[model samples]
Target chain A: MADTDKSPDSSRRSERSRRAILDASLALVGEVGYNKLTIEAIAARAGVGKQTIYRWWPSKAAVLLEASMALSGDAEDEGEWTGFPDTGDIAADLKHVLRLTVDQFNDEKYEAPARALTAAGAIDRELGEKFTRQLLEPALVLYENRLRAAQAAGQIDADIDVRIAVEMIVGPLTHRWLQRTNPLTHDFADTCVDQVLRGIAPR
Target chain B: MADTDKSPDSSRRSERSRRAILDASLALVGEVGYNKLTIEAIAARAGVGKQTIYRWWPSKAAVLLEASMALSGDAEDEGEWTGFPDTGDIAADLKHVLRLTVDQFNDEKYEAPARALTAAGAIDRELGEKFTRQLLEPALVLYENRLRAAQAAGQIDADIDVRIAVEMIVGPLTHRWLQRTNPLTHDFADTCVDQVLRGIAPR
Candidate 1:
């Protein structure tokens, strides 16, 4: 317990504290929401000194951002990160991913924290940019990579902008989820994939 | 000025107060955001009593909702509400609408209040549903109507759900605007329209 910072035991204790802080962040944000979330509260919930949190993360948003990333399997542990699937069938692959998205969006544990972050980001430009860069952008890169692969395979049109193309697949689901305009369903996910891939116009 | 509510002069005065209240609501929301905005502030800014606002609208969200509707030309003045255009060329028409949306989203005056409401809606389920039904749904209906017309003209696939089809056109634009993922531009709008109409697959 008295080991120095450079020692393996010390590092293990630090890692445990980090995990506790992140888990507390997600739980607190889900309960009290991002606006009400405070560093002191997170520290209390994690059973750590407030200084410990400050030493590691700059802000509550930063803590929550990392927590959300970890929840989505986008943690810094590169070994656990799985990129978008590509089975050479772009439409089918997209549907699979989107269906999973639907399930995630519907999951109460994920929804509260995600919605809190999203809501906070909407009004706070700094947090919005940070969230976009730290969390959203990397996830988007996977879609872009998949679309590029599709282009190479002659599945997607060669001229399509993969960046914008990624939005087409993700946007409607987000819009539906955020706006609560309709039920998020597997059928809707499959429809989005079909329409985007085949186009809504008559062939 | 002592006339009753049935009097024309009293009605005109009430109309002026209503306009002032809505205008003040928009201005205050822009300056302070939805959460910080209060009935007292709006009333003070509008030069009316707090009871005046409550007498007309149930809550601040309602006041802001009306202001937003008016800003978007969706006011109860039926003659002023121009439905989505039907040029028989669905792509051209959609691009036209989306380009205007890009402009609206970019406008600072519109951006502040709209962002406030959107942020509030994200956290507050009741407000979110009210905003959707009161402000957003009507606008979505316009898109649906246009898509239905295209379907009738055989410009769109007959089997496609017009409701879902409209999302493909509007979703990306909204996602870019809200998430600030990329520039909302006429070119992006046209690309969304073209891609949705033509499908992303090789023709």
Candidate 2:
């Protein structure tokens, strides 16, 4: 086939089918979870040929990975992982983003799909790696970047290991959400910001 | 139906079957996960009739819950919530328990069963609350008591919310474990204690 044979119309058709496939994949994954989420199920739900999905994505993991990206708006960002937001007030910026996270955690639309992906990642290693590479590492880079900025501004101790420090902030909020241990709210977000900024030790 | 005339032999036999059932239930949950696990399977695996399982536990969740407590150790304490340790050095106690926690998180034997039960708890509120009571609350009380002691000692800020502070330490480690985001280690524990104690600000 000539280079001209790869035309815009064909590309558009492929893109539409791909979008349908991803939507169905994500929805089914959330409804039934990953193990029960199958190639046949996705095709049946998407109203597309199973061969069409296989032609584009290699496996259920690949399909779910892309579906999750679509769910997270990664396509618009392409594949570039820009790290955390760095407004001048590191504390406020961090709090602001965390507050948004609280909202996302509380939102039903986002929760189920995210849970589906996460549950699958728990037991499946290769899928887990794909999730880390495609979704999680990017989010973490943002944290690392924000911490580096804090270090540069002398807002944080220069000797601090930023990678581990990021977890200090994220781990608790995530723990609350994943474990359903407590209500994660704006007040909870404020508490997290307060504790992280001020030493827990008596000043 | 005279109570005093009841055969002790039947009751003893019933108690033995109960242990066998719980053991089999945990083994199946650890292997097949909660969703795919069944009463029939538990009964068959235990070499007991299905009626024997239903006569005690109401569902697979109940079975798993009892099995979880059984496998996690009989805890032999007087059925009360245990709080954190107090070496008077707040940081040291937190680190010591967390180091033990790192061992628990990495233990292959507990890992799958714990992960499966935890994942189920993630989406099911009633089950989640039960887990919090049976599995999580005891640990929290320990921290609560420890923090109270520290408050009295002025090791930590007196006005600080102990529950929130405890979550700060717990949230990150759990997020890392559940999300497959990173490793939890003794170094990770030490760093969390140091950073949290010092606060993230330049001291």
Candidate 3:
């Protein structure tokens, strides 16, 4: 309604504004941190009105979560979306997926916003739960499915809990990421895959 | 020098003040979060002068770190600090230690301040590194030593890196704690211990 332009033109403009807002949100969060980041600042940086932000998102946390999702979407587009890579070899498949995870973690686009959301998620339980369910759970489900496949193939113990087993593979890499203890490398990914499979395979 | 009273009375009063300041810092961080928490507010709530807080700790992070350390000290007093119990059963010992960790994480005294520091540390690299070194590394070293003992006993692969092996044990619990996905329970602890030991035991 605000636009004098046609429907397609208006839609394109709206998409541009949305991208700008998300980019600004990520940049500001990286520079100042999640706690100090404000919608007004995001609006200023994006050259959009505060009303434009509020119209699209409920809170700063919501905005950041969207920005994070956008980053994840871009990574998925970069060949990381190939789910679980079930090529009959569970270890190689897992290593492939985890190596891509390491790449995603190390990507400059993903780093700042992910860091911001994680910090915000720590104190704000509601936001944490929302992001976890919407963002994290879906990714974990892919792991769960892959593990289930491995179980069916007899590569893993029939008694192994796929959910917890998935945690074994994902947990260390996530710990390293959140703790910033070391570089999240392909080598580290390979090690995690090796250890986790060794744990779940029949004695 | 500032106290009118001398020796025993002054020392007792100083100790009381320190405890009060720590309590105030924890309470404020829980209520307002780490970003909003201020030393001025801590001093006011503790019924001490600003100078009193400054004399004891260098910064707000330092105060929270001390408070967090105090909670850790209390947990240690509850017999959790007894190190990895070597009953020759590495699985049982690691599970026992991890169970104690679940208890400490569940304790109310540790929750708020711990959450505050984690959130703060996510954005503030210096605080993260300081706490990681001072608080986290010591606990990790205990696990490392226990794994070394297991290696010597021929219970574990001598070639396994204790550093990454330790993460196999610690990472999942930490992930559960920070993510607040589920109750950090004895059963969870046992599962992690079983899975990790299975991974590192000689094939």
Best by lDDT: 3
Q: Write the per-residue lDDT of candidate 2 for residues A1-203, one digit (tens) a residue.
A: 12234689977777788889988987888788777889999999999999888877789998988777776685236432234567788788778778877877787766777777777776666777779778888877887887687777878777777887777777788778777788889888887877776642234
Q: TM-score of every model?
A: 0.91, 0.88, 0.94
Q: Stretches of candidate 3 above 4 Å error?
A: A1-6, B1-6
Root-mean-square deviation of candidate 3:
2.3
| Best-first order by TM-score | 3, 1, 2
Model 1 Cα lDDT, one tens digit per residue, B1-203: 23356778879889899889989999999888888999999999999999889988888988998888777764235342356778787777888788877877888878889888988887889999999888889889988888887777777677787787788888888788888888999999998888787763234
lDDT of each: 0.82, 0.76, 0.84
Please tell me the TM-score of chain B in candidate 2 relative to the true structure's chain B: 0.84
Q: Which ten residues in a row have the lowest lDDT in candidate 3 chain A?
A: A1-10
Per-residue lDDT of B40 in model 2: 94
The list of candidate 1 runs beyond 4 A from truth reads A1-4, A74-81, A200-203, B1-4, B74-81, B200-203
State the DockQ, from 0 to 1, for candidate 3: 0.69
Q: Lowest-scoring 10 consecutive residues by lDDT in candidate 1 chain B?
A: B74-83
- Best-to-worst ranking by lDDT: 3, 1, 2
Candidate 1 Cα deviation (angstroms), residue A111? 1.6
What is candidate 1's DockQ?
0.62
> Which tens-of-lDDT digit does each residue in B5-110 have in candidate 2?
2578977777788889988887787788777889999999999999878878788888888877876564335332134567688889988777767777888666
Error at A16, model 3, angstroms: 1.4
Per prediction, the TM-score for chain B is 0.89, 0.84, 0.92
